[model samples]
Target: MLGIGVVASILGIAAGLLIDWFPVAASEEAKPIDTLWDVLIIASVPVFVGVSVVVLFSVVKFRMRPGEEELDGPPIHGNTKLEVVWTAIPAILLVGLCTYAFIVLTDVEKAQANTMEVRVVGEQFAWTFFYPGEDGKEISATELHLPIDRPVKFTLQAKDVLHDFWIPAFRMKKDAVPGINVTYRVTPNRLGEYPIVCAELCGLGHATMRATAVVQTEADFASWLEEAAKPPAPPAGGGGGDNGKGLFTSNGCGGCHTLADAGTNATVGPNLDEVLAGKDEAFIKTSIEDPSAEIANGYSDTMPKDYGQRLGADGVDALAKYLSEVTKEG
Candidate 1:
């Protein structure tokens, strides 16, 4: 009966493991990582079942009957051989798993000669990607675009505080520590959009710290790189209104604040549409320049503090005016 139960448990667990447990395998690294995960599940389930069966069988077999309340159970001596076997088996299994994991990690992280580089910068609540362009210039973007099947290396730097760069589909993650640069490489095999998330808790806006990773065909990626490498357009409305919109998007405000005109729908902070509704230009300006001065109810002081310097007087004024105009009541 024990043997039959063990077999049933193993079969059941194996069936369960067949279910898709990860996002699509979109990278070369995904195959090995996934294989290791399956091995773990298969090995672990049997151990779990074996222990459960022993405990349950012992409970039922040694259970006291109604008429045996005064009886003393027989004492059993510990088996040194059994103890040694259990300990040695687990130790060997653990060493084997670790060794296999190390090999997988090593193989996945191997660098290629022609690997492209992208500088990833993580700040309070946003991710900025910089790619090498023509004439030693780097083009900056808020979204990450990668060519499918091309090995790309990410050089991560934190502007302030610690953050983590993680792409679930690619199954690669690395830390972004302040005053330090960390690097990780991945070769995307799937052509689709994926979310770039900060895996570490950095600050109030950490939850809202999100960005898009677009895996594109080589042709599309080349076109995007060409366009992005050009100089930016002039601010719309001539007063920097359009520039304000660009700033809002590039600076990562859309990741947390909801703004109708900008099409941002994040709820990590108070919705900018509602927060700015009926609010005056001065209030909106103050909010952007000194967000922590009067934080909206139910929102924390997660807004970046250096926007005033970063945007400059003209840009801040333009953003304030844009917000006021777009969010004003009819």
Candidate 2:
């Protein structure tokens, strides 16, 4: 039985090691974290096989038989050496694993020189990223963009409820708690687009809370940052087309509503294309500012009610006019 168990344990460990279980590693911090996971799997599989083997053997060998239904089996004392061996083995394994984990954590978290700071704000159903711009201003965007091979320190904040800022490829995550700030750091070593997900369930639209992280060449990143930092051009003829579209994209409206004009297909909220057809600008503006005034059929009042504050009067007017124009019936 011991030899059979050993063989099974070896096979299990090999299988665990061979399985590809993670997403692509895109950051410098991901390597050590992935290694830690592999180490855990290697250590855990043998213990799991040993336990299962013992349980199965006991069940087969010592289970009550038909003739022994009313019998109490022989009384047995606990084995002191066995008890100590099991306890001590687990204790030593835990201490070693924990010490290794601490070392990996410390290495990943060591602050690097010239780490760029990015502010991440999580609201119900949306994530907004802010990067420092020229002077004292900040450039805000719905998508996170990082320069490849640069260390980035993210300061996370939540406006309404708790949200977890997770980048799986980077293998780093932290919670954004309301009324406080949390931080984590990563250095992008790959040039690719990765997903940004809210690991916490914030609200009704929690599952829809998603964003993209783009790692770009340094020159491209610099160019994009400079362009994004510039003030938005005023809406043409008081908020009709391009500027309103920009607002829609930047504010993450596409994350909830299905807007054909904006090329968004998310249905967390109403289908703006169908619902807003023939609706006037006043109604649209009210819907944007006070979304809870009238709940749509088969939908909850989950829209954020701060568009009036987030986008000022002129901004709201522009967005209203834009939606009104795009969804207008002939």
Candidate 3:
């Protein structure tokens, strides 16, 4: 016990000192989480090193020799003191950790006055961000834009399967499950573009499920929000279209199609604007609702089998009409 304590203390002290020597950049809102992690490491390191040293010592000292294999070992006996010590210590430590983690989680997610509200909806392979536009109406899109230094409250929910929303630099992540809404807050300290990865494997195309989160100055974010609020620019022919066109990355259309106008870089599908340029509303609607009915030139039949069900009749109608209007004439 004395040896174990000395070794553990020495190793832990060395590591702690090394870590302290490095500079750590703290987040504006993640301070509470960082503090929680620090406490856990302090409490855990000694216990971890002590157990490891003890295990190694036992392995080396009690290792069976070649001649000892045929002989029976001494009668095994359990030590009450050792068992009680392990049990009680682990229980107490776990309880403490749970308490501190819960406090940090709740404190970080608590609503703050003047916090920005954005609705984050996730589907099988896409994410849509919604902001309150003029008249307090909702405007939806595929990209995420947040103002730096301001707390952004995200109301996260799933439209289809389960997906996790994570921004590593911000140190905040939460699951978006169907039928339940999860919330988290982030105050982006940096002004740059970061990738939003789906940490949860929702389906086959999970590997390609990604979006960009742009953190800009307050003025830039405000201007971007205003631009996103404007009605989605007409597609091609002047007519009604789906309102959800704000940002639809899930259709895997981005995987094969190239719609430069929509900022979609997907090369899996045909150039949408070029393909739909001269097509009438019926032609475009049929192609989207019944994609396999007429494959868009070089694209496959994987353009979301249930887009009709996912977006519904009105959504399909608007999208088809919008496509017809937006597709540039060949």
lDDT of 1 by residue, 200-275 (tens): 9987667889889999999999999888777553332121113567677766678788898988888888888887
Q: Which stretches of candidate 1 lie over 4 Å from their true place?
A: 63-78, 202-207, 232-242, 277-280, 295-306, 309-315, 328-330
TM-score of every candidate relative to the true structure: 0.84, 0.90, 0.74
| 99-151: candidate 3 lDDT, tens digit per residue | 88998887777776778988887776667777877776677667889988888
Worst 10 residues of 1 by lDDT: 233-242
Give the per-residue lDDT of model 2 (tens digit) for 186-243.
9999999999999998876678788899999999999988877776533421211237
Candidate No. with top lDDT? 2
Model 3: CA > 4 A from native:
1-27, 232-252, 255-303, 312-330
Looking at model 2, report the run of 10 residues with the lowest lDDT sum.
233-242
RMSD of 1: 4.2
Please give the lDDT score at residue 148 for candidate 2.
95
Model 2 clashing residue pairs (backbone): none
Give the CA lDDT, 0 to 100, for residue 267 in model 2.
87
Cα lDDT listed for each candidate: 0.82, 0.86, 0.72
Top model by TM-score, which number? Answer: 2
* Candidate that beats the other on TM-score, 2 or 3, i.e. the better one: 2
